[model samples]
Target: MTQLTDPSGQPPYLRIVAGIRRRIMDGELSPGDRVPSTRQIAKEWGVALATATKALTTLRLEGLVEARPRTGTVVAETAPARPPRRPSPPASPSEQELTLERIVRTAIDIADAEGLSALSMRGVAARLGVAAMSPYRYVPSKDDLVLLMADAAFGDETYPADAPQGWRSRIELGARTLWAVYRRHPWLAQLGSLTRPLLVPNLMVHGEWMLSALDGHGLDPTTLFDIHVLIYSHIQGLAVHLEWEAHAEAATGQSEDQWMDSRADVLRELVDSGRFPTFAKVVGAFDDGYDLRLDALFESGLKALLDGLAPIVES
Candidate 1:
């Protein structure tokens, strides 16, 4: 039976899992069917978003639900009934050979897979099969752990020691490389602002690349660094949305497209009200709704930014 409440005194998330699991097993929710979103689950069950998220995470770990990029979480087509991801406790802690490298890598994996906010030292220890406080031996705290994680993430890609001829090409290479890192580690953008930037050595390699490219372009030191900061800001600004979108999906249990679609009625009312003639005209011409491809947007904006900078380089 679908559990309306946790009469068995199980945790709220477990109760959610039981109710959803029952629904799935009884063939009520077929393959690829839209499941109740996190918001809907929270509302119906009177639980917080995190609890609802945990329930969904449990389902995903069990291979029951899978998150689709453009679609929200849905029933897996041929999901195997399996246990959730909490592994067996270690028989001997020494067998795992835990080290600072392992600790940072595990932290990175968690940040990369889930997100920065989802990360906790205890969680890293759990994944590493060690005592909850074991990670404290190597990385003292979550803040320091994140710094190391960001350093490792930034170090993943490197530029050639040999120079590309033009400043534009070099700048493009640097921007794209940094973009790839951010794309790989979306959580990286969430840390530090332009004013209070991430000062780790690995991250400075990218700044060095940008600064080197702008060096001989007749611009003074301030102007050169200004241009560098502008380029960096462009990438960071757009990249922040990557994490935001991911969190939004987890919280609302709606994909970007789904969320936009849900808001269509409101948008149509605003558009048809004739207050936005230019907006309506531009939007009305699309036969198919716009696809918000962040990669394409990144590339397009990069080109425009370079085009504007080309004049400065030439002068």
Candidate 2:
């Protein structure tokens, strides 16, 4: 089996690990010294976040580095000089066999596992066990690749021919379908905004589904489009936080609950301070500390939004 190499004649992640390992072995990065973060590594080495993450994971496996919660990754106190181990190259077909579909699917998987920030042409090629530029042959650039990914992701679901009856039911199905896609690929919400929407065929399938639901209602075009946009905003607005929370956890090494617990003392003080009685009462009402379930929130918000718009849409 042939080992894939980047331009440097070594796998990108290994090269990164070697660089950091050399720094540790040379005492440049002493024990407990802060090591460059994943973002920093990516920026400094011109690699993707996934590549940087892999380098850090290698170092941790070698016991050369350790994570220090809010402090970021640091050189372990007892660093042993061990040569970096080469990862077993993945079994992949030659670049000649690579297809556009394969490239887009691989890119989507990368963005899904890691955040969108972690995706890059080189990273996808690396995962596919091809040369760094192999993916670029199929996808002109990362931006184009992302658009392909979005289209493919949105295309995952389709409305059945026997669609649910009633405008509200049809609209509900469309909204839930979109929310499900965002739930699967949280990075998707970060792709486009309301003003600048992602104009892709598969996404248009969703838009068409939604717009058609509101059609034949004797409603003016402006009011009809307004309602459509409003519904989309609710799903996209909340979905944006999904990626954000994942990013926060990755950067801070704390889950939402853990991070909130870390600030419990401050929250307790804020609640006890007699300044805001109403706010305190709301905080006091929860039998158990609030667990922010985004799914529940999405359902509740969707129902309320549809309920409020029922009169206008029905009329």
Candidate 3:
């Protein structure tokens, strides 16, 4: 409750760091204790959120604090002697240092760490420590930046020169490759839907790979493209939930498992109601509760899909 400040006129963030550091050293905040969050620090110190974030970053660099996923920042297990003070804001990169590739890569990193919803031009600029409008000078707009991000994300993996031999193996390779990209960047799946597909060139590279696998199978143009789309949709449909689950957890402060467990009573009521006998039997059959592993589901679905399409392509 006391005011936090240093008499020597240190910056506001440094003063906050000194206060929290004092608490940790004096055993007022023990190891594993939840330290004041950025929001809390901002409120208590009457400084901006950016300043609070910088204070925490400084503490983290010094090994005095660590961030836990669901849990906020906590005092680290050990606190070493404080490192020498650094400037409040590190020098921003020169204009010459800012390039389109750097901006796109930084934006992708933001979307990967925090969902795409958290991304913004200003936020990206702040992370880059540049002016608000700096990225726009390169990217023009967030939508364009997202397109570039998706293109880069999709281009991460490619088909090998020695193709997998069989058409089915080739198809599996392409599908799994795309799946890996989605798993790496879950936000990629949320970019476009079947009705309005993403038209990026790198994405088309994936499409080309899959279509080429089906190319010489003697199928007509329509059927060939249809098969390719079906396979793509299979990977993408399940992938859409990845980002959705992330957003749900952030919004509700509960993981998907926690949220499902919370609905046990409702699940029991449904079982007892007996309106859906098959659903009840399935739910009751699990000795240990089912763990929804997306990777396993992706593989299972891919196998089933390829099996079904085998006769069509082979015919």
Backbone clash count for every predicted candidate, in the order shown: 0, 0, 0
C-alpha lDDT of all candidate models, in order: 0.86, 0.85, 0.84
Runs with alpha carbons beyond 4 Å of true place in candidate 3: 1-91
Error of 3 at 106 (Å): 0.3
lDDT of 1 by residue, 36-78 (tens): 8888898888887767877887888688988775567899987
Clashing pairs in 3: none
Candidate order by lDDT, decreasing, is: 1, 2, 3
Using TM-score as the measure, name the better of candidate 1 and candidate 3: 1
lDDT against true structure, model 3? 0.84
Clashes of 2: 0
Tens digit of per-residue lDDT, candidate 3, span 36-135 = 8666777788876656766776788689998664466789987765544664652477534888998889889878766788799998898788999989
In model 1, the clashing pairs are none
Which portions of model 1 show Cα errors greater than 4 Å?
1-92
For residue 167, give model 3's deviation from the true position in Å: 0.4
Worst 10-residue lDDT window for candidate 3 reads 82-91
- Flag the better candidate by lDDT, 2 or 3: 2
**Best-fitting candidate, scored by lDDT:** 1
